[model samples]
Target: MTAARRAGGPILVGLPAWVYLPAALGGLFVITPLLAILLRIDWANFVPLITSESSRAALIL
Candidate 1:
């Protein structure tokens, strides 16, 4: 096919490229909470909630 025909297929060229920044920031907004939970976690409580072998299982994952 010709260039014009390909352009009609997806039409990604000369599009609103600024959407990438907001899309990436939106993804970060979703993941930031999970990161905070991992960071401020109480490691000491794992001994009761997770035994030695269970803790090893968690690590293996």
Candidate 2:
């Protein structure tokens, strides 16, 4: 085992600068759809709609 492992200290690894752009794009790609869905929600009736019997049934299914 290495000295760091033997001492139970955390090991850090450096990543290449080119790796960040693709990582950021992938994160934005996942988050954009969720943000769009949230924007489309009818906030005025959100509570009642979510608490209705049909909504409960659909969630249960």
Highest lDDT model number? 2
Clashing pairs in 1: none
The 10-residue segment with the lowest total lDDT in model 1? 1-10
Best by TM-score: 2
1-61 per-residue lDDT for model 1 (tens digits) = 2223364486434535787799899999999999999888778785676667877799899
Query: Which residue pairs in candidate 2 collide?
Result: none
Candidate 2: list runs displaced more than 4 Å.
1-12
TM-score for each prediction?
0.47, 0.77
Candidate 2, residue 44: the lDDT equals: 100
Tell me the lDDT of model 1 at 14.
Answer: 51
